[model samples]
Target: MAKKAAVLMLILFVASLLAGCWNRKELNELGIAVAAGVDMEEGGRYRLTVQVVDPGQVASQQGGNGGAPATLYTSEGDTIFEAARRITQISPRKIYFSHLRLFLIGESLAKRGIGQMLDLLSRDHEFRTDFYLVVTKGTTALGTLKIMTPLEPVPANKLFSSLETSEENWSPSLSVTLDELIDNLTSQGKHPVLTGLVITGDPQMGQTKKNIANIYTPTQLQYSGLAVFKKDKLIGWLDEKESRGYHQIHKGVKSSVVFIPCPEGGKVAVEYIRGKTNVKGKVVQGQPRIDIQVEIEGNIGAVGCKKLDITDTATIAKLEKEVEARIIDFVEETIDKAQTKYRVDIFGFGEVVRRADPKAWKAMKNNWDEEYFTHLPVAIRADFVIRRIGTISDSFLNQTKE
Candidate 1:
């Protein structure tokens, strides 16, 4: 009887702890923000634009018939925090940022500095660091967000997917996350590079419902070149070729296409199979020098030259040498631009020096970027290998019979 009484008491205590939901929030009570854009307005204020998803429309099977997937709301204030709270005045539901996928900053705002905006994001509990960070080139961040995409009902989702795909396949642009940007801002001897986003057509038409009605949208968002920053402030931009070269030195290129001119009046396309870059810093006699070694392997993608024989081992050797030379040139050009034009160390060479020679790095850490990095000598060595020649060993263009 005593044991039975004890067991009953324990069961009653456990039952009391399993009460109703205390912190549960209804989905309808919150406005899910899929993307956020920040721009600078006149009078030293911030303009915040958020893309809030419509659950019913986003979840509907009959896509276009369900209305727009998201609606954009804008608010302006002296600070980002104030601007964010002001959004509640216009929005019916509470804005929630836990699901945000993209964060965009306008070119003008980026040039001014993004440290203030970054501070609020870092302190906010509702925001996550996984979302991609991008800069709107030649337009405001609000304009980029206004552009609607056809294939993906949600414009924010489209931007997120496009950024990932471009970074994986294309070499010109690089995606930077919130955490990575913060890291770059804090780290010494290195700067940050953000992928640029641009609106291609009429900005007004992109915000309308008719933007997604046709097979070809009037306005579209494009991933532009890389925006280079020095301590949270935008300094300059890198073109396609220079951006690719930066990727080569930074080991950002996963796989890309490289075209080399053939001996004949044609070109040979090679798909990058694999590439690795190693940067080492050395201090000799109080002088800094960086050695960059890159090893690349690729397969022949297309042969436009008819006279070039793919089966010949001599031809393959010559092509490999040519590829190596081209890679070296790319690295040199990028270093020159960084040294002479930007005068910023976006390559993280200071960190390399720090690790290699700590004592020497400590002495130069104070004025590394402005003094040492600008005049640092960089030596590039590239080795290339041709792994395969597509499906056939010999191209059909080879008319010479064995």
Candidate 2:
């Protein structure tokens, strides 16, 4: 009888413990934040801009009030956490960040350094590591977030989806999550890079409902060049070409289009179907060297040139050579810029060397970026093969072009 009573008591206790949800927040008392922006205020203060979804408006079928899907609230304090906490003074409900998609660091804040902001984000259990981090180009984080985007009613969602799609189809832009950024920042060899966001057109109209009402959005957000960083500080910017080169060198590019000048004038557009890049690092006679070999397979997307017979194997071979040269140029220019202009090792060659020869890395680790990396000898080789030339071998452009 006693044994039966103990078993019953244990069962009751276990059930009690399992049924309750500890520290549970009811949906009614939570304000779900989808995007957050940080900008440095003049007095060394921090401004936190949060974009919260308007659930009812977002669900509206008839485009609710010109599709104002998200609402922005700004607050200022001495620190990021303080600014975040101050947001509650204006916001009715307690801010929740599990749904956060984007984190924007303003140019001022990014240049000043993001290590402090990252500390708060890393320590706080509220902020997820998966959210992307972007630096606003030539504007505050708030300005970048204020502009309403077309198609995706919510500006935050637009930025998130646009970056994801852009990275796949475009080579210049890259998407970096908080975790990835932290890893790169913490790593000894590699520094971090983030896609820069720019607000185009008039800023005043971007915040209004009229921004999305018209077919032509007077104001829009664009993912521009990659923001190069020496540690957490923004050192400089890489143009679209340089950014593409970075992508190719680091194997960040999945697929993209390359336009090559044709032999007979005009340009030939090619779709990169498959690409492979191999970066090897080694110490030869006490000097470090890097070898980058790239192989690409692509198909003719468009031929804007006059009189090119892509059907001939010789023609395809010549086109392949042009493609290879272009890729090689991209790789070489990116390496040269990294060595001379930036003088930072964003390519992570140090890590490659470390893995290759630990003893050598230990000696060069301290002066890798400024000394060794700045004058690192690099060799690049690219090979390209022309796949199927679209639906038709040659463009009708050849038939009519004079």
Candidate 3:
């Protein structure tokens, strides 16, 4: 009987503690941030824009049609922390960041510096590390958060899907998360790249506010090229073609399509199936010299040659050589521009030199950006193999021998 009485007291004690929590807030009392954008404001201040979810509408989706989707709020301050605090001025309820799916930085802000903006994200305990980070080109960071995506019920979900698709089709367009960005910033060997976005529209529509579109993408955010950075500051932008070449040389480029001009003066599209780049770094006279070998195999998708037969070994071999030459030209041009014009090691060649010849890198580590990368000797060789000619073996224009 004494044991039974003790057990009854324990149940009452648990019930009392569970019923009286003062920190609890009603669901409608908080504004959940779906996405965040950071940009450089005038007078050396920073601007923060947040896309807040409407819980009432989001939760009632099963029975009712989606309403207003998400609302965007903007705030400006000297720092990211201060900017976030200023958001409370416009926000009716407490701003919660537990559901943030994407973070965008304007090109101007990225060029100025992202380390300061990202500091708050890393130190904050409420933010998750999986949020996608993108660089907005020709658009303000705040503007990127305002555009609504079609098909997706929520704008944040659409942004997430855009990044995911880039990874599967064009690997150079791989998505970078908060955790990965932080890691690249801390690592001395490599510099992180972010996807670029732009706003486009019909000028006559008069609804220019909804014109935001990632240019590389026909529909949504595009992870097309690398945003070359000197440490944390963005140096320059790489075009889509240049970005693909950079991916082939330094980053992970699983599959990509290249349009090579045929002998008959039209376009021949070849889609890559397997690609591998091998780099060899050698030290000579206290300088770094690197050799890059790219091997790719793909099948021909279309042929514009009027007289050439794809099944012919000679014709196929010549086509393969021409494709290899085009890839080499593209790769060399990108590297030359990056090294000579931008002077940033966004291609990660510095990492290769460091890993290959530690002694040379150690001696040249202090002045790598200025001295080493500028004068570093780089040799690139490309080899392409046409594995298959699709379903039709010969070109339609080829004359058949009876």
Clashing pairs in 1: none
lDDT, candidate 2, 23-131, per-residue tens: 9999888888999999998888999999999887888988667647788899999998899889888999899998999999999999889999999998999888888
For residues 178-278, write the lDDT of model 3, one tens digit per residue: 88888777766567777787655532231232433333323343355667777899988888777777777765456777777766578778888887899
Lowest summed lDDT across 10 adjacent residues in model 2 is found at 393-402
Against the true structure, candidate 1 reaches a TM-score of 0.92
The better candidate by TM-score, 2 or 3, is: 2
Tell me the TM-score of each prediction against the true structure.
0.92, 0.96, 0.84
Clashes found in each candidate (C-alpha, N, C closer than 3 A): 0, 0, 0
- Candidate 3 local Cα displacement, residue 74, angstroms: 1.4
| Best of the two (2, 3) by lDDT | 2
Model 1: which ten-residue window has the lowest total lDDT?
A: 393-402
Q: Rank the models by TM-score, top first.
A: 2, 1, 3
lDDT of 2: 0.88
Q: How accurate locally is residue 283 in candidate 2, as Cα lDDT from 0 to 100?
A: 97
